[model samples]
Target: KRYSSEKSHIQGTSKLALGIFDGMKKIHGMGARERLLLQIAVLLHDCGKYISMEKVAECSYNIIMSTEIIGLSNWEREVIADVVLYNTRDFDTFEIMKQRDGMDKRTYLLVAKLVAILRLANAMDRSHYQKIQGLRVVLRDTELQVILDSARDLTLEMGLLRRQSEFFKEIYGIYPVLKRKRNA
Candidate 1:
């Protein structure tokens, strides 16, 4: 049952990532390589949850640092781990920027961008039960809109939408407005 739940959660996250990626591409014209990195960031954003809840982010970093996931070099793993760790709301961007000062500017920017998207995607699936049926991303001149389709009660959905919007605004420098898809 746990495995099944995890699988469903992963699938939901993937869907959210796809929507966010598509919106990002349209909004910022991201290239293939950037898109790939963003996808990887999204996939592994919550891997830390496998460890204890208190230190899930730290555990995720440790896992990535210690294990060799295929197609990701050690340096790449480090970047991903850093992005994951920094995605937590408790950490401020200034702090993360300070830690990243020694690294290449391009790498820091890339990790920051991916982390922002991953954070939003993770928040969109807060239920961990695939309750969100689908998502639509709309790109406006000054803001991004995420329309969530769900059949369940609104409390969890609203909470996730609000959290995701916060990350979206912080990362993209654009306002994020979330609205439910009302049945006609």
Candidate 2:
């Protein structure tokens, strides 16, 4: 499904997503399966944007739900779809849980983690320029600081991340701080 210049966008988002996951995995104790799921979800998170911009995330959720990818199992497809749905915007996690049914607490928790990671990672690539090269994440008691290694000014990313980070903060209980990598 991922190919060409579009593939690079996937690649860029994947890099950021994995970086964020890796940055937090130890602190959060993320399992390998969930990490792989996060990687797959990020890779395909934007596939629907190509078809319609107005309903990009919803479209992405529809596409992933209907189409079966090679490596993803049926439930994995469902999980990815949920991730795609939440990654598209700053949706309130509590509000979402209230609206949906049949999801147990564990599923809700996993979705929360996936969406938190995807939200911040997707927000970093908001301009689609992939201006962010790499990053280092340091977690304090209740804050996650992401120091980006980028050549371009991150005004756009910082602004967007701030807007989109509330969901992440709410779910993870950690305020996310985005900034440039300081001189060594």
Candidate 3:
């Protein structure tokens, strides 16, 4: 059933990606090129799902590292794979950012940024149903509130917001609270 689903219907990841992009733009002032790159990362974050759930991360990594989809360069494909692998909960951002004894700083920072955005977007769609209809941001002096509007009850939505808000907090240093519109 999952494989047969329409691309539009399977858009939870993209929606959340856009939300993160919007958040980054508003809070961190990310420019057009940066936003475009982040958007690409977000769009391809779930391409792994097409392979298998068990070790889907590894599958995605292999596919990105091997494929020439959309004519992306070898380095660009490597960046995609790195982002997918590091998006896991076990990976440490600081350790990755260190550049080790010989790793490249440019690659480390680039992958870190991609993983950060992917983490937030993946959390937003905890249900993987694309249930969230839209998201809005209200920036306060000390807090940033993200309002999520859904077509149905959002018991799962609230939980996702809690988990995903960590990324927002880390990126912007602003408190994030999720609010749903009351039934009228």
- TM-scores for all candidates: the values are 0.82, 0.88, 0.75
Model 2, position 167: C-alpha lDDT score: 78
Q: List the residue pairs that clash in candidate 1.
A: none
**Per-model C-alpha lDDT, please?**
0.70, 0.80, 0.65
Residue-pair clash count for candidate 1 = 0
Better model by TM-score: candidate 2 vs candidate 3: 2
> Model 1 over residues 1-184: C-alpha lDDT tens digits?
2212266776787788768788768565567766666666556666777766787778777776777878877767777777777767454455556675456666666776777777777777776877778878888877787887877775765676676666667667887776778871
Instruction: Please tell me which model should have the higher TM-score, number 1 or number 2.
Output: 2
lDDT of 3 by residue, 21-114 (tens): 6765666655665565666666555567677777667766776677675756666667667777767645555555465423366666666666
- Which stretch of 10 consecutive residues in model 3 shows the poorest summed lDDT? 1-10
TM-score of 3: 0.75
Task: Tell me the tens digit of each residue's lDDT in model 2 across 119-177.
Answer: 88888987888898889998888889999999887888899899877878877878999
Off by over 4 Å in 1: 1-5, 92-101
Model 2 TM-score on a 0 to 1 scale? 0.88
